[model samples]
Target: MTASYGSAEYQGYLRNDAVTIAEVLRLDGYRTLMSGKWHVGGSYKPRESDLWTPGDLAHPTPRQRGFDKFFGTLDGSGSFFFPHYIGEDDCQIAVETDDFYMTDAITDKAVDMIEESVADEKPFFLYLAYTAPHWPLHAKEEDIAKYQGMYRNGWDTLRTSRHEEMLGKNILEGNWEISPRDPTVHSWADEKNRDWEDSRMATYAAMVDCMDQGIGRVMAKLKQLGVDKDTLILFLSDNGGCAEFLAEEGWVESYPDISPEGKKIVQGNIPNLAPGSGKTFQSYEAPWSNVSNAPFRMHKSWVHEGGISTPLIAHWPNGIAQSAIVHTARHVSDIMPTILDVSGASYPKDFDGVGIQNLDGESMFGVFLNGHGEREQPIFWEHEGNCAMREGNWKLVREFGRDWELYNMAFDRTELHNLRDKDQNRAERMIKEYDAWAKKTGVVDWAVICAHPAMDWVKPAKPEI
Candidate 1:
């Protein structure tokens, strides 16, 4: 959804014509508040004004995207400590304290927004996007200390262990094999600088742990306000683990080597430099990311299972059935329709005299209650040159500039086996469907974008997928 849809021009900014869920909810008398990672639209620096407010009220801002209140950054990533581009409604907010952590700050603001909404006696829709566990690998020392030495065994063994655990818990069927270690990743035994690699993954875990702690705080706040059971809380990750290396060519040149807090930002795939320091902008890289998306091939950006698959958690004691796990495939787009269905909100046929697009997703409230359901349309994905389509038990996928590969998702969800050669006609049929969909959606070919000069620095085999 964040990608360049329809055309390359649609890539970065959230188009003005879009009608967001929050907008519809506002019509139904709900207050919408968002805190954290507002990458959908807007500029961090307002040219004409020096006001420090919640969000920019003007063009291409989250406030324009139906969020009445916004507190976050405009970009995908940044220093988690003293993030340079934080915003409050209509203006930029300067981080003045040395102890500022982005995850904690986002949560704190969300809690305050919730309290204010309660005091105002208004129902609220809060989009609290925690930019935790993302790149730049920044985590508190105490959080980093908890996972010290935990990843010493390396990604190869860790992937296997995680797969085993998933199998034991019936989270995955026994028919699948843990896909082999990512081709670009070295075997743990063959890896030199083992201690440093271990530290990198430890820091990544620490970021996730710290995020969990913050989530606990938010949940505690909800409970304290007596809204725990009444409020429906849904949590999800946008994509699978990221394998992109930041030391690629032109990256350091593009981003500065100093943070807003005056700390020297370390850049590169340095072996000895420990991550989780506020001064580093390093990624955990492919090997560990491979472990994070265990049993699935590839990482974020690719059209692979590991790239797009995410665990969705929904908690509503008064509404949803408890302890139910739905294995049915769902897309992120389904979130809007589900919320609208629950709230009895209507998607406008026309807004401001222009026809609005119909929601792409179906209401998933049934899945919450019945623990199983089916989507009417086949799932489709395209990023870079990678593309995939899933329909029932069959999936057809291909890497950019590569031949199509087919798999029976029911039997080979790990994508370890290719059944394309065995069923030529089925593959051809699905390819035809994908082609029609692409044409209708005005999808720009990857060949067009990949050749652009801006993509010159992207390394081919990293986990950036």
Candidate 2:
């Protein structure tokens, strides 16, 4: 009915939470399938982004969790080709197909699972998280070819254009101001290394476009299986477009990984050295990443809106409300319970002696029954330097330990107006609420988390704050 998922540490919780979801769903005899990246444990290599085999399956892997099937990569970064991803019992396909991209691979697996379920006449749950357009951005030759010079206009133009498109599509509200291009990403025309800059964004867009095609493939399969109408598909990014290329050179022509044990590993170096070939070594770089997170400030790690915000599209012909509606109040944690509600699963109090955490989410499944109703639950998020609490339209957010900023989300979606000083009493109340939530949720304050852990790759770079 429902599922838990996320990046690294978050995924760890998701795995544990999914177990909670599955045991409950089993009471109703429903099937759950997970197909995507599961980056939750210690990386197998010295580097964080490396993708390879015999990954450290030390902790609870997807197999141990509630998922009957799992398909995904271990580390975050990888060459698109011959990625370190592997499928679970059913997911581990024995394909010797040559030159198959990871995005296509996962989609194919999902389609296979769906077809299998249809044959078995089983009502199923599927988590299809595309690892594309993330890092090590690589795409099919034709996909990369489609955007030859599409990004020559630079991020400023691209971000503005995409923002306009989102608004035109009614995907964005009338009040939000498109955030400016990130200062870190230089304009292509002004960039000294024009070839590299041009290739970077072209690669990023190609990755996204390629994934879209892969989604089309999955949809086609669903239609063929005649489950297109009955199935529920939730499409969204895990977080806002990431901008984590800490090193100036995001691409190395070759991705080099050396294990803590000193074993040198290159991500599908063969057949990938060629520019157009989708391989694991390359990343889309920063300029286009700026566009991927349109009209939002900051990237993945920051607690800012841009870092945490994502466009969520819920579609199910049988279950979804017909009217196109936007539910701005939902958070990632809410997804699990919502799915559970649809499949009619109960949340078990205890499973295998491991007591499950209470559901931090409420089911908006009622939305399908009674239009998109108001969320009775408040939205809360904390990760890295970002911390936010949403009670109705009022939101309180702070970047790291900096002073809290207040915004009336209903009026100022971009959060350009800071009402902290203007509304001191409200700000104080919100801060107190956030402090309580942070303590309750095990949020490791970035100031403390990074300091003792040597958070960055470059060690001992202490936080000035």
Candidate 3:
């Protein structure tokens, strides 16, 4: 429902009326299970009295929605070591071990859940929503050690190297060029505290590395269960690298003051003290995030390619004919329709006496089989006042309170060139299309959303929708 953190409209949670893919699968006789982050629901606390009631608008837990089993944190981001609001089914759980890492713990539960589902002799759908690679950048010592000093060459070199690697592997197609480095970022050679900067990226890499290892463990479990070939596994990130820094005043109040081991949590990007420890809370910050979204412009929250573009990898040994990179532009909404198409489930018009919203995305099953999919309508996106619309190769995008810029994504996916002035008619037509879509989707103006009384605590540099 496009809910922002601490917003009064949604109270930072998903609305209850929205039908989830898990619910549909459950109705189709699949044992739905989930582990890891569950940030869509109301804030879950350790206290039983604080739990959400049935009538609450933003309090539908995963179990309540459709999952037969659920285990994860209710909040979006938290300390990996001593998480703030962890839940198992309906109740909260405490961190029982000194060395308990959130990523590993999530993997453990996922493996266990798979075993239980298999033992019950029912087909299962496991949603392993790992909260790795998000802020407070925390990772295990071993994972951090592997990436130590790896980023000493800095983000600039990493960008060039990664872009070349992607091109060589044919992952990028059609005359795509890397966008220039963000102007606000300093050249690595001119930067002071190179060691600290390198450490930030290293810690971030370690978090991802740990998550990858956990994924491998899940794959191994699938193989052991003799369902590796039959099961369909899709992997994708929620968004691009985040550029948000944990430097806001009184930010520590949002998190636990102390760790589970009674250690005081040291917060913010302190230059001297490196990240990756339970006691420290830090973010990779913008400079490294620019590297994370290498060859693309901008970070998360923007409608730019860098913020919205992410690879959707599908692995189904039995279903897919061959491994190939598909350059089709697909939205996150398409995942549900694709799942339903693959599983032979029907999308109901009504569920539990409530009308279901019409699907905004088309099934991507054709793309999976033939590496191509057709869309009847253009894709539209609006996040934090940054709006964009894409129809075939043409794209119209604009930052808040700015003139629209156009690009032919076929030749300039990085959006380095602007065509709005050259093709005014096309730009105007796309703008009208975007406006119509926005109005139909009930998209509120950025200024109006930011001015709401609920956002008084938020002091953003720009209006956040």
TM-score of each: 0.93, 0.84, 0.94
CA lDDT scores, all candidates in order: 0.80, 0.65, 0.82
Clashes of each: 10, 9, 0
Model 2 scores worst on lDDT over the 10 consecutive residues at 1-10
Full candidate order by TM-score, most accurate first:
3, 1, 2
Per-residue lDDT of 1-465 in model 1, one digit per residue for the tens? 333333534454554455888888998899999998876663323221333233333336677767788888776677788565777887777888889888889888998999889889898999989888888888999989999898888888889989999988888744598899998887899989998998899899988998898889889988998888888888999899988877634444345567665667777668888888777778888888899899999999888889988889999888887577677788888999999988889888876566777678888898878778888889888887799999888899999989999998888999988999999999999999999988877677777776655455332433343
Report model 1's TM-score to 2 decimal places: 0.93
lDDT of 3 at 368: 73
What C-alpha RMSD separates each model from the true structure? Answer: 3.2, 5.4, 2.9
The better-scoring model by TM-score among 2 and 3 is 3
Record all residue pairs in model 2 with backbone atoms less than 3 Å apart, i.e. clashing. 1-339, 1-340, 2-340, 78-280, 79-279, 79-280, 80-279, 80-280, 303-386
Global Cα lDDT for candidate 1: 0.80
Candidate that scores best on TM-score: 3
